[model samples]
Structures are given as structure tokens and as C-alpha cells.
Target: MEIDIKKHLTFPVFLICFLLIISLIFIFPALKMIVLGAILAYLIKPIAFKIQSKLKYSSVSIIIAMITVIIPLIVLVGYISYELYSVVSTIITSGSILDINQFISQCINYLHINVNPNELSQSVTSSFETIISYVMNYSVSIVSKFANLSLDLFILVCSVFYFVRDGDKCLKFIKSFIPDDSINFFDKTIEDIKNVLRSIFYGHFLTAIIIGIFGCIGYSILGYPFGAFLGVLTGILQLIPIFGPWPIYWTLFFIDVISGNYPRAVVVLLFGFFLSGVDMYIRPALSSHYADIHPLILLVGFLAGPLVYGIVGFIAGPLILGITYTVLDSYRKEYLMGDE
Candidate 1:
């Protein structure tokens, strides 16, 4: 009477998997954008729902929410890009670099180092020129591929809209595939994944924002040029596992030291130390309520993600890894430990 259930299901499951593989192959090029959109949608869903409570129209709420959130992000990115270009171009063209070179020479002499200052200056100039040139070329390539970029952006927007609106439906549909026995595991895994996301967002990203703000205020008070930009860079560097605001403040400190500004140097160094030290408290305080993710997971994700998924991979990599970890842990708890 059982009628060989496993035998009958095998062909159907195979057929479904085959179709999925084919579909994935076709959408491989736009996969990153699609993933990015889904991630954004997940983050934006609450905002959209808040708006929907007022508007009573899901689509309109989502649109307005997207605009409000996405516009500021776009503007911030554009401003950073423009400022970076301006700084690089100015450095490449201006005589200010010579002053920096002179500073380097003075530092070397003060240290009683026998290295050739002219050779070192030439090397620094050459390295900067090469890096700037490469970045400029890369920027040009991105502009040249406007059509492709537009297509990706279009796909991203569409994906976010649909995912935000239908995400619950999608989750239900997925749940339908889970066996009754494993449903608890699936639910637990999803909860863990959500916790992971919250942990990363609050622990890492929020900390970065706070540190960046402090950097901006401190550097400006110290009379540094491009203080805001340095702060932004500090924030970004804070996202990486091993690196923090030390690089920015240390460099500034050394620059001040070479320029004979000891007071500013000491102040900036102390400020930088504060920025670094505060992260220890802030990250744990924010994330401890959620999942505890290992630093290695994030480090690998951040480092290797861009290679596979481009810039969007930065977000996707850690997320995917964190989710994977949660799923594995859930499986162990539900199956392995349960059996034990």
C-alpha cells in the first residue's frame, strides 16, 4: 500500500532540480544584482511596512521607502566618489606632494636613517601615480559600461520591489518543501540567520558609523584637510576585521610629527586610540543580544567576496557565510544532538 514512495519521488525531484539548475545558469550574470536586491529588500521591508501602515498601499509604500533610503545612500556614495577623485587629481597635479616629500626627508633625517630621501620620494610618487591611474581607468571602465550598469540597476530595483512585497509568500512556498519532521529545524535556522544579520548590522556597521563621526569631528578640530574624507575612510576600514581606525590616525599623527605639530599629533593619536578602543565595547554591546559570529567568517567573506561577486559581494559574502553557519548549527542541534 505504501507503493514505493521514494522510487516515485526520485524522478520528480530530479526534474525539479534540473529545471532549477538551468534557470540559474541563465540568470548567472545578473545573480549578484538579484542577491543584492533581495538583501536590500529584507532590510527595507520593515520601513516599507511602516510606510504601508500610513499609505495603505504596499507598492507605493515600498517605492517611497526605497526612495527615502536609496537616495541618501546614492548621494553619499556619489559625494565620496567625487571627493576622492578631486583629492587624487589635486595630489597628482599640485606641488603639495613635494612638501610631503620634504616632510618624509625631515623624518628620515630626524631618525638618523641612512636611506636616500630622493629615492624614497620618487618611489612614493611613482606608487601614488600608478594607483591613481589604475583607479581612474577603472572608473572610466565603469562609465563605459553604462548600458550594462543600467540593466543591473533595473534588475536590482525590480528584484527589491517584488521581494519586499512577496517575501513572505516566497518563504511560505519554500517552507512547503520542507518535510514535516524538519520544519522545526528550518524555522530555527531562519531565526538564527536573522539574528546573524542583526548582529552584523548593529555590531559592525553601527560601530563604524559612530567611529567615523568621531573621526570627522576630531580631525576637523585638529585642523586637518579632508577631515571628513579621512573619517569616511576610517569608517570603511573599521568594517574589516583586523584593520581599524589606527591607520588613519597613525598616518595623521606621523604627518603632524613631521610638520612639527606635536600638540595636534598627540591629540590625534589619542583620538585614534579612543576610536579603536571604543569599538571593543560598542561591537559586543550591540551584537551580544544576537548571534555570535566568529571574526574569521567575516574576514574571509570580506576578503574573498569581491573576487566572486564584485562590490556587492562585500555584503552578500558575510551574509551567505553567516546563514550557512546557522544552517549547519541548526542541523547539528536538530539531527545530531537530538539523536545523541
Candidate 2:
């Protein structure tokens, strides 16, 4: 007896399948991390391949490349942490609070305004003390989280190794699963992803390094306190769109203002402004040239990524959008428009 397929499959079966997929997603979140690592490995494959060709050992080359990349990052973090601690210590010991209060009072007096400076000073000091206490308490939890993150880092490193070793075979296997008609489309999409990664690595990451180096050198030359910390802050902020460097620059400016070091502050501000403007030109030009994508698309992606996925969203957002556009264009040209 012949049976109808639709009669046997019902709404409940669909619901069960949906729930099962969702559960699997939660259980296998590591898949996302692996995918991220694979993308990173692909971007750095050229360097790994070169090293392997010279050394004749893929595993050793991969490990050496990973260490070469990771060591600088570790050193940067350690330096920044130490510099920030030094700044905090200096702020606690120096009479910065009193100087700031006096400067505020002088400004108010010059404006012909009458106010109780002593009361204002006391209130500000109390608030600052409370904030310091809260931050001290919070540091404990932050340290605990850092310790746990070590495990995640280990997983990420392992994933990077496997991705580098098997990346070519993996891509080939995945391509085999795609339909013959859509192979070209898939190839174009992969190329788009590579372009995006290249843009990110060259444009964003390299620009950040340049800015950080400039900041550190400039601040140190000008005898700015916590120069290293400010530089690192500036670099990290560069990762954020638009307002990233403003906070660090402004904080240093205000500190100078309160300390009666207006000349130094003005110089720092001018230097920062120049460096930041240069970054604007460098990032867009590099991104456009490498990715062959519109700068406007990148600008929009930078803004939209954080709104959609928080910090990591910036990278993910641009990548996903770029791939989508490439795939859709390929589909239109091949099947619908029949041009390519």
C-alpha cells in the first residue's frame, strides 16, 4: 500500500525538529569559536605557508606563527596594566584633588560667581573616595574572570592549530558538499570573506598599532603620566567607531588643565588631533583598496556591528554583510541576470 508522506509528518514533528536544533546550538557553542579561529587561521595562512616551506614542518611553523602573534599581545596587555596601576598610584599620592578643586574655584571666581569652594571640594572628594572603593572591590571579580578566561584562551589556541593544519582539506570537503551549479557562487563568497579579513587585518589592526605607537611616543616625549596606559587606551578605543580616542585624550587634557600645565595639554591635544585625522584617511583608503568595498559600507558596518552584537559584533557584522552582498550579486548574475 502506498502511503502519503504529508499524512505521516505533522506540525508536532516540525516543532520537535526546531527544538532539537535550538538545543544543539546551545550545546555546541564551541562551534562558533572554532569558526572564528578558522577564519583567523585562513587570513594568516600565507605567513604559515611561507614558514612551513622554509622549515618543512607544518606543525612547528603553525606553533611558531601563533607564538609570534600572541607574544606581542601579551606584552602589550602587561605593559598597559602596569602603567594604569602606576597612574592610579600617582593620583592617590599626589595632591591632584586639591589642585583640581583650586582650579575650579579660580574659574568660578573669574566668572564673578559666588560659590562655597570648601563645600564643593569636600563633596567631590567624598564622591571620588566612594568611586575608588567600588573600583577596588570590583577588581577582585575582574581578576577572577581573567583567570577563567585562561581556559578559553587554551581552547582558542588549540582550535587555531587544527584550523591551520587542516584548513585546505576542510575547505575542499565543504566545497564538495555544495551543488555543482552553485560552486562558483560559493567560491565568490569565500573570496569576499578573504577580502574582508585582509581589510580588517591591514586597515583596522595595523592602523591601531600605528596610533598606539604614536600616542606612546608623543606622550612620553612630553612627559605625560601613564603614557603607556594612555597609548594602549587609544589603540583599544580606535577599535570602537568615532568616539574611541576622545576619552583618553580628554582625560589627559583635563589632568593637565588642573595641574596648571595648559601648554602641555594643548600640545598633546594638537598631536592627538593630527594622528586621529591621519587614521581616518589610512583606514578607509586601505579598506577600500584591499576589499574593493565601499568605505561607506565599512562605516555603516562599524556603527551597526556594535548595536547588533556588542564588541565582537564589529568584525562579525562587516564580514557577514560583505559575504551576503557578494553571494547575492553572484546569484543574480549567474541565475537571474545571466551576465556572468
Candidate 2 colliding pairs, count: 0
* CA error at residue 4 for candidate 2, angstroms: 14
lDDT of 2 by residue, 242-288 (tens): 66566787777776776678998898788878777878888888777
How displaced is residue 265 in candidate 2, in Å? 3.9
How does candidate 2 fare on TM-score? 0.79
Give the alpha carbon lDDT tens digit for every residue of 1-340 in model 1.
Answer: 4678766678778999999999999999999999888888988999999999999999999999999889978987997988887887787688788887888799898889999999999998899889979988998999999999999999999999999999889999999989998898888987987888888888888899999888888888888988888888999899886788999999988888888899999999999889988998898888777987787887798788888888887788888988888788888877899898
* Root-mean-square deviation of Cα positions for candidate 2 versus the true structure, in angstroms: 4.7
What would you estimate as the lDDT of candidate 1?
A: 0.88
Choose the strongest candidate by lDDT: 1
TM-score of decoy 1 = 0.94
In model 1, how large is the Cα lDDT of residue 20?
A: 100
> Cα RMSD (Å) per model?
2.1, 4.7
Least well predicted 10-residue stretch by lDDT in candidate 2 = 27-36
Where in model 1 is the C-alpha error above 4 Å? 1-6, 9-11, 89-94
lDDT of 2: 0.77
